[model samples]
Target: MTDVLRASKFSEWKEDFNWDTCLTGREKYGNFLVSILTSETNGHVINLNGAWGTGKTELLKRLYVSIAKKQHPVIYINAWESDFINDPLSVICAEFLNQLGYLLANSRPKKELVDINEALNKLMGSISKVAYIFKLSSLGYKAVTGDATLNEEFDFSQTLLDLTTQQNSSSMSLENYNKSIISSMLGNQIDLVEGMKEIRIQITSISHILCDIYGCNSPIIILVDELDRCRPDYAIKTLEVIKHFFDVDGCNFLIASDTESLQESIKCIYGQGFDSERYLRRFFNQKIALKKPSLYNYLLKKGIDFDGMCPNMTLTPYSNDNERKIKLLSEMLNNDKFELRDIERFIQKLTACIGYISKFNVKNAKFINFCVLAYGIYEHEKNVNIFKERTNKMSSHGIHCNGYISNGMSVSNFITIHFKMVTLANSSKRYNLDGGWGSCSYQTEMLTVESQDLQTRDWRREDLIECERLIQNYRNAPNSFLLWEDYQKLIGLTDAIE
Candidate 1:
């Protein structure tokens, strides 16, 4: 294909840049689901939790893409944007029916509804078992009474109709029904909803036949993202309904949420007295914490050739191609016929001027003029005295930046030292130059030194103070366990992995 190099404002932020692609295959999260799908153990539900912008969605998306391509039917739904305002069971039922309707519309028109509903009911039964295992399943319990044995005569419709039609339906009967039928039989035991549960049960009973329409091998996996956005009651109730109904029937569920929110949501449904840890343990078997990469490793990974780059180059490149582009710019500026050594010498002097003036209350315009004059010597044939004259003019202006050091002792000498040190400390590989990283002491002292207007104090003192505390705390208290823990968390994220 011919190279197309069009440029426009709209294209600037477009995904076509392919910034997110990687050259090699990185680690995948497929192992987490392997056991859930293959083992004879009870079906699994997992919550992939993390902070916003931390790559939870991306990881889930990739995992879904991989698993689904193998012919396992995967359905993705972002609950954060869904309009599921009804009972949790109703939402699941609606989704199942919608999917089943699509699956069976052409093939089995006659038995479509019946097959689907029967499958749904069986699946719901499995969900009830899971709920019972989890505890706090629901309020209803079943028992035998007049007319017939409870299992034989106590079906959902009759019980719901009996509850609604008989004006004298005792709360005791409702309570018993909850214990025997609702608790033992149905998964999302919402039967206590002021006739709302009964209503849901009736609807679920009628619509559940959709599950049978799906082929036996065609199990569906529904992925729900951003449960963290739901109200606690809504979020927890939704989770329970999913566990009891959907998860029970051989359908798989993957939830993307904030762990804290999911915990709080469960608390709301099962009551604050519920053991939050145990409740969470039921759904999430393992947790993967995610965070941003450390600055030091991040910069090094960009493959910066720091020693070849100018110390004053503020527009740092994030990739190798950008670094080449910058090197080209550097070479263009050098071709003005200034000796390469002279250019380096002038930058040394300029850095000194910047340090001195930055400490004082010099006008920005004057600073700019000084920089222009410093660089003007390259093109124009200015003698050494003129350079000295311009340099002396700033002394009375309160910039003590006039002295030229013997290579190692001046404030100007330390400007590059300081920049390189900070860069290396953040994410660069190592100190870029030879001589054993000797500039570190000078850099540290320079960093601590107060400038004329105390600009350093205003800009960086609080941050320095925090750093000092961290150092002191690290020294006096415990081990570096917390630091290592945090480091591990940073790498397990999609942002870092991608």
Candidate 2:
């Protein structure tokens, strides 16, 4: 047995949401999102917007699972994955078809599935046409801007030839053929701006067939996750494709992203001073921020575990023990550099360090737990070993951090004096620190010490004061619980630790 807390409790834990717990605090918000999807409408584009790691993806997933009973077919597309592909149309086609296959899995008759497959292939041809138009437009852009190193005139001619040859099986010329279809969709004028209309018709056809095949009258709900983490072009283009092409009457889109970053991305692509938020607003009719979670309750519910401790101590709240710990945790976390995820990290570290305490005192569990978390928050998790190693160093090399000299000021005295205050605090006891161990705090009557408590076999009169000073400082400043690297930093040593 390793006598150490299993690090897996917090580090490897994921926030798993089920129907009952998913709506615990967010019942209204969950209902609001599902209501929008289930509302009588042709379709919708809803953005679940928030800062990075504010649980936007997690929120969307909850919505995804919760909406199942709403009778809507859902598809989750990780739009950040668009980075791997260069062509926008190909990216959309791949994500949509991959998820569509799953949604329609074994739902249709064999003959109908064959027919649906043929219809899907034709829809893919329309997608290929979309890719072709994009390629042509890129060449046109290079020619217009004179930004191409290659000869644009030659490239354009070669591209046109390739297009014509590829479609020569048809009677009409390639340009006339595409224009004829576009003109039909637009009723006369073919503004490439209205290119959306042609693709919209094709996508609508696909959605209808998909609905019949998936056996759902409700709209197909497509949840796009991790949009903000994608590159600027990919993120913007994916949104555009969904709006213009995939905005069919029977399909809905729920996109999750850091809306601010998406706005910043628009600014980056469209140039400074452009209203990126306005551009985003045009795409998303409704936006909801992910609900913020309470850090204290979240940690408490995690049920902090310590394997090397006495029974009945892991996060079992005593007489206001949780409150005391929460108060200190709040103070330490006042600086927002540590997000919810970061706080969970320190809580895990605290549980692990508490496992290493020798002669564990169940009475002082509250105070010790506070120091464990405080030390972890202020320093690295590996620094938990510093207490042991620092004591060993003091016993061997006579290095005292108390800024004083004393005979028989052994490591045991230092360890004893420090944990004593913890014992006193948990037990509602105090003693004088004016001339006692003042390492953790500078208050008189800070901790109680009895005659029997003072072990002088390897201690001295001066050692008592020095050890008290050491413990007081540690009590006052959790940063004093320093690892070896911190020591090297204090001494300006650049050499790596062995």
What is the per-residue lDDT of model 1 for residues 1-498, given as tens digits with 9 covering 90 to 100? 001111111123223222243111212334455335423123456676665544556555555544433434444555654434645554554444333323333233234443344344444433332222222211111111122222233232232223223243332334434455544334444443333333334333333332233222333556677788877766777777775555543455677777866677677778888888687777654555534323233223445443233323221221223343323223323332333334344444434443433444233211122212232332223233333333211222111122232222333322222222111122112121211222332333211111111223322333334333433333353232122222122222212211
The candidate scoring highest on lDDT is 2
RMSD of 1: 20.4
Clashes of each: 23, 26
CA lDDT of each candidate? 0.38, 0.51
lDDT of 1 at 442: 36
Give per-residue lDDT, candidate 2, residue 84. Answer: 59
